[model samples]
Target: MATKEPSFEEQLAQLQQIVNQLEQGNTPLEEALEQFQTGIKLAKSLQNKLTSAEKTLGHLIDDAGNERVYENNTDDPSNNGGGNRGFGSGDSVKG
Candidate 1:
């Protein structure tokens, strides 16, 4: 059976342990190399997760509790709702 992939926290914890072990300099060269590779993979996975989260969090919401994606143009006149608009801003900002 295939092994389950670790969650983000688990992966981060494993990566930390790997770093600690490698830093101790007690592992044999070959074993240390393998740990290093594993750590790199974990790091990449964590990074990708973080990137995905940032994109998700960056999504702007409209006044009616609807999600509105931010476009490349920050100065778009259509989006000028001041600080009261988007995300968790109060209902007063609703257009």
Candidate 2:
């Protein structure tokens, strides 16, 4: 389910849960650092999600008084021992 699309609210809630645990849980230095790194990742993810939403909403306004929408079709390769990331179209996999 890692690749499944998550809503903005869901992502924010999950990130808060992670932060709260890190603040309350007692752990060794190494584990704490690892959690900190994870927190950074979650922060980036939340930022990206919010940015995308903002962009989508602003797509209705343009310099020429026209409205347009942008679609992200980032190519993602399938997980068949290939060299692609496999997150979008133009990719195939073999079982």
Candidate 3:
């Protein structure tokens, strides 16, 4: 049987574990490369999920009566939508 895709949280947890393993620097070069590739894929998936959520939610309201629209500035270098931030980035989901 085919394995089910992991949930976002599970994927993020796995990505975090991969990051920790990669950071250890003890893995063989070949294995490290594979892990790095997996990290890249996971990062992309997480980013896409966030982008979708932003589109679905429309906008957000801050605690101080501030309304903010979800805008994705892909051109912004500071936008950690990709590998910019360490693995495991997304909005929290409660089951």
Candidate 4:
């Protein structure tokens, strides 16, 4: 049987643990270097996963199986020219 892959949260926790260990300043030079390298790889992987998730969330899928980019309607004139729409405002997409 193949080994199971670690989830994103698990990887993140591992990276945090590595950081804590390095911060303690007790590990030997060679071991510390190895841990640092591993931490870097984990950071990059986490970043890539976050970026991919963001891209996925930035789009909307219609019932017609068409994909559309999610856009903020901050330019709507009904707001009386006030563009102070807070976060998550203008989430509705007009057809």
Better TM-score candidate (2, 4): 4
> Which residue runs of candidate 1 sit more than 4 Å off their true CA positions?
1-3, 63-66, 69-95
Residue lDDT tens for model 2, 17-83: 7678778877777887877787788788888876676566645657898877544333332342233
Best by lDDT: 4
Poorest lDDT segment (10 consecutive residues) of candidate 2: 73-82
Off by over 4 Å in 2: 61-95
1-95 in candidate 4: lDDT tens per residue?
99997899999999999999999999999999999999999999998898677667767999999999775434364653335566557577669
lDDT of candidate model 2 versus the reference: 0.67
Worst 10 residues of 4 by lDDT: 73-82
Model 1 lDDT vs. the true structure?
Answer: 0.81
The candidate maximizing TM-score is: 4
Model 1 scores worst on lDDT over the 10 consecutive residues at 72-81
Tens-place lDDT per residue, model 1, 1-93, is 999988999999999999999999999999999999999999999999976775676579888999876633343445542334676656456
The CA-based lDDT of model 4 is what? 0.83
Which of the two candidates, 3 or 4, achieves a greater TM-score against the reference?
Answer: 4
Off by over 4 Å in 4: 72-95
Quantify all predictions' global Cα lDDT against the true fold: 0.81, 0.67, 0.79, 0.83
Tens digit of per-residue lDDT, candidate 3, span 65-94: 887865543544455333234434554557
Models ranked on lDDT? 4, 1, 3, 2
Note the clash tally of each candidate. 0, 4, 0, 0
